[model samples]
Target: MRLARTLRFDQSDENVFERAAQPDEWAVSGAFEFSNWSEDDLSGKRRQAFANGWLGLESFGRATFVATAKIEEQEYRALVERLAAHFVEAWGAPDLETARPVAEKELAFMAGLCDEHEPNTLLIVERSLVTSGVSESFRAIAPQEATLDLVAVHVTSDD
Candidate 1:
């Protein structure tokens, strides 16, 4: 199976998100967090997050970029448990048993988003408040063949 993991090119996420997700943590669209929000509620970092954040499963934080990655079944199961627990604590789910299916569906949707892309392909989600509720759209950036090294470092010495 495949899912998205947070990627950090810089420290901007730390500045923009309430909590910045650590690089490589699992991520989902996480629009669920704003289920009850109104236009008046969209301001500041919350606005930034609503515009373009991927929710990290581990930290429950936000990330601006996420890359597709392979996931083992065991790890997927573990994520389900963690997310279900979160639903209980964060959303007041009746119990773990009731939250389990909801968590599974959330993860499954994330996995489906990765199904058509290759590993390391970056995915972005843009969300906007529609009349009924929030609407999400995804864009994918596939990795390209590099003609030269994408990064380089210079060393200086004084003698």
Candidate 2:
């Protein structure tokens, strides 16, 4: 889902880097592509950002880090519409080709996924972000405002 969010950096602390790398409140509210990968990467998306930490699933051999930006709400609907079109034009969501008004359909698809994975928004971060040396590289120049397009699939208990 596309929602407005802000991740302010508190550079005052000695552990600012540590704080930036860790997931914030918005991370729990929705899944985010923290990386710069295309939304199509979501079909194979398996990693997510959470309040406590991250989650990953290796489904059908598709997974990657795709960071998400927190954006303003005014542009949210347009972005979703653009995303729907992006999938159809760039990624080729064949089924969406037939779904008149692709944006609404995309919204439903995302909403359904969100329903199943609420209270834990996904985040796409490179292994380097959460892994060793995270403190030095994860720092943000300023607070961000963007939407999160979550595509990571949560594995079942059996899986």
Candidate 3:
């Protein structure tokens, strides 16, 4: 069964940077710094800064994954759009409509392959480095009808 896993912007703690540095097999690639949040114009803009920061980080991660993973471009772009929506939902944006243009542009680099399949599980990790806050969330969805099996097997078997 095909599944789509998306890491939406849920929340994060201050230790996000530290946690991101750890070796995670699930991670698609190494961490990279996001610089869009360094705008001097947003000094007193707390809410805007927070929103930009979240989106910036999410985009950074998504870009890394799209470049590294051998998935279809359309699938990656859709995932990016979903991520932007997730960011707006979590941060409470003043104008979600305006944000879509920027999100689309950000995802424009991915433009090909429309038959990519989604993953079985999507993991979301958010962190506020400036405030030292962290939030981790995840969601699993099946694309089609399916059944999950739960079985317990003894680690040690007795003859």
Candidate 4:
């Protein structure tokens, strides 16, 4: 029998999120930086993406490195579109051949840590981009309380 990972959230602490960000093995290439609260950014908006309570993927540049946090599917794709737009303006269309799978692998890594899949869950990627590239609407949601969003983040860098 296939046992689904428990996808419960700790109302007060980020430990649950921290554990969720990690899997037995990582699929993406690069060194994984696992921390209680690792720092990360999306474009110009910096946040505690790696902390026990955060969500989404912080992809810095193309094939550079990737960090992750949990996110909703809709929110996730929206961020990717933002990145795609950024890449299109800068270089003219993104080379998905290199982008899509990388994001998927990281997404799956986090998913595996969950007890069960939630419909609202997402696979968002926050590439290191200029804040302007991201729509103001995305930033409108201030005060990201951990309880409201069951997510976590992890950073990665090559030695």
Q: Indicate which candidate wins on lDDT.
A: 1
User: How many backbone collisions does model 1 have?
Assistant: 0
Q: After superposition, how far is residue 87 of candidate 1 from its true place, in Å?
A: 0.3
Candidate 4, 3-93: lDDT as tens digits: 1111223332232222233221111211123222222442111232221223312322112112223446675565445434434453344
lDDT of residue 141 for candidate 3: 32
Q: Report the C-alpha lDDT of model 3 over 46-124, residue by residue, as the tens digit.
A: 3222322222233222210111124455655565566457547754545657656655544442221111334433323
Model 3: ten consecutive residues of lowest lDDT: 23-32
Tell me, by TM-score, which candidate is best. Answer: 1
TM-score for candidate 2, please give it: 0.26
Candidate 1 residue spans exceeding 4 A from truth: 147-159
Mark the 10 consecutive residues where model 2 has the least summed lDDT. Answer: 56-65
Model 3 scores a C-alpha lDDT of 0.33
Ranking by TM-score: 1, 3, 2, 4
lDDT of 1 by residue, 1-159 (tens): 899999999999999999999999998889989888899989999999999999999999999999999999999999999999999999999999999999999999999999789999999999999988999999999998775546555556952
TM-score-better candidate, 2 vs 3: 3
The lDDT per prediction is: 0.94, 0.33, 0.33, 0.31
Q: What is the lDDT of residue 131 in candidate 1?
A: 84
lDDT of 2 by residue, 1-159 (tens): 432122333432113222232222222121222334333332311222221222211110111221233435555455455555544664456755443365555444434434443232443323323433232112112224454545456778999
Candidate 2 residue-wise lDDT at 135: 21
User: Which prediction has more favorable lDDT, 3 or 4?
Assistant: 3
